[model samples]
Target chain A: MMDFISYTCLIVGVIFWFWGTIPLLSERSVLFKLHSLSVSDTLGSMSIIFGLLLKIPREWPLLVLAIVCLVLWNTMLGYVLAYCSSSGEKRENR
Target chain B: MVGHLIFRLTIWFLLTANLSWLNILIGLSISLLLPRGYTNPETLKEWLSILGKILWAIPLAYIEAFDLILRPHNDEDMVCEQVEKKRSHRLVFLDILLITFTPKTIVVKYHEEGWYEVHRVTRRKKP
Candidate 1:
C-alpha cells in the first residue's frame, strides 16, 4: 500500500514539475504565470513529500524538520520568482 | 551569471540540508531548466565560488529591490553606500541599488559611450 502511494506521489510530482514548465513558454503576463507555476510546484511537492513521510518508520524529528524546510524553500522560491518577474516588468515599463 | 550561480548553489545546499538523494535528480532537472554555465562548473573551487555568490546575492538582491520599491517618489540622486556587486563588475551598491529602487536617477554605464553619465533626472536636480 505504501509503495503504491509512493509511486502515485512520484508520478503526481513529476506531472506538476512538467506542468511547471508551461510558464516559460507562456505569452501571458509573467506575474500570473509565476503564480500558477508556484502553486503547482508547492502542491505537487507537498503531496509528494507527504506520501514519502508516511513510509519513514520512526524519525519524527528529522521528518518534521525536512517538511518544514521543504515548505519554506518552496514558498520562498515562489515569492522570489514573483519578485524577480515584477522587477523585470519595471525595467520593461521603463 | 553571478545571480544564476547563487541560485544554483542555494538549490544544492537546500537539497543537501534535507539529506536528500533527490539531489542527483534535482540537479539534473535544474541543468535541464537553466543555462549550462551554472551547473557545469569544472572544479570544487568553481562550485564553492558559485555557492558563495548565491548566498551573498539573494539578500543583496532583496535589499536592492526593497529600496527601489520604498523610494518610488525620489527623483533626486539616489546615491547610497552599500556592499559589493559582482566579479569584474564594479557595481557600487549605490548603482546596482537603483535597478530595484530609484532606478531613474541612475547614471547607467552605457557601453556606447563607455561612461557613466549623470541621469537626466539627477542632472535636473543638480546645479
Candidate 2:
C-alpha cells in the first residue's frame, strides 16, 4: 500500500509540473503566467519531496529542510523578480 | 517570549535530530548565546500581532482560491488590481509571503511611495 501511494504521488507531481507549463504558452500577462507556473511548480515539487520523505523516514531532517526552503525561497524569488522589473520600467519611463 | 524560545528549540532539535545529552547541552548553549533579533518590547508585540493576522489570513486566502477556481462566475475574466500605499517594507514582505503561498494572488509590482500592485483573480469590485 505504501509503495502504491508513493508512486501515485510521484506521478501526480509529474503531472502538475507539466500542467504548469501549459499556461506559459497562453497570452496572459507576464505576472499571470508567472503566478500559475510558480504556484503549480512549488506544489509539484513539494509533493515529490513529501513522497520522498515517506520513502525514507530516516532522512526526515533533510526532507524537512527542503520543504521549508522550497516554501520560503520560491516566494522570495517571485517577489524579487516582480520588484526588479517594475523598478527597471520606472527608470525607463523617467 | 517563551513561545519564541520553544519554537527555536524545536527547530534546533529537528535540525540536529539527536537526543544525546551533549547535543542537548550544545543546543541549549548555542540558542542562549544567539542574540534575540527584537529589542523593543512594543515592536515585538506589534510583530507578533501581525504574524497572528497573517496566520489567520492564510487559510481564508486558500479557501478564497478554491472558490475562485472551482466555481463558475461571470467575473472570471476580470482581474482585481490593488495598490497598497504607505506600507513598510516588512509589512510588504509579509504580504508577499502570505499572498504567493495562496496560489491565487500574486504581487505584480512594487513601486515608490510604497505602492504594491497585486493581481488577484475574480473581480470583487472592492479595494
Model number with the top lDDT: 2
- Complex DockQ per candidate: 0.04, 0.38
Best by TM-score: 2
Q: Pick the DockQ winner.
A: 2
Give lDDT tens digits, candidate 2, residues A1-94. 8877878767766776776667788786666665666646666677788888888788898789887788789877777776676568779889
Per-candidate local distance difference test: 0.48, 0.67
Candidate 1: segments with Cα more than 4 A from true spot: B1-127
lDDT of 1 by residue, B49-121 (tens): 6557645643453343334334432223323333322323323322332332221233323233233333222
Worst 10 residues of 2 chain B by lDDT: B72-81
Worst 10 residues of 2 chain A by lDDT: A30-39
**Error of model 1, residue A89, in angstroms:** 1.8
Interface RMSD of each: 11.9, 3.0
Error of 1 at A70 (Å): 2.0
| Deviation from native of the Cα of residue A37 in model 2, angstroms | 2.2
By DockQ thresholds, what CAPRI class is model 1? incorrect
Off by over 4 Å in 2: A25-28, B39-93, B108-116, B122-127
Q: Which pairs, if any, clash in model 2?
A: none
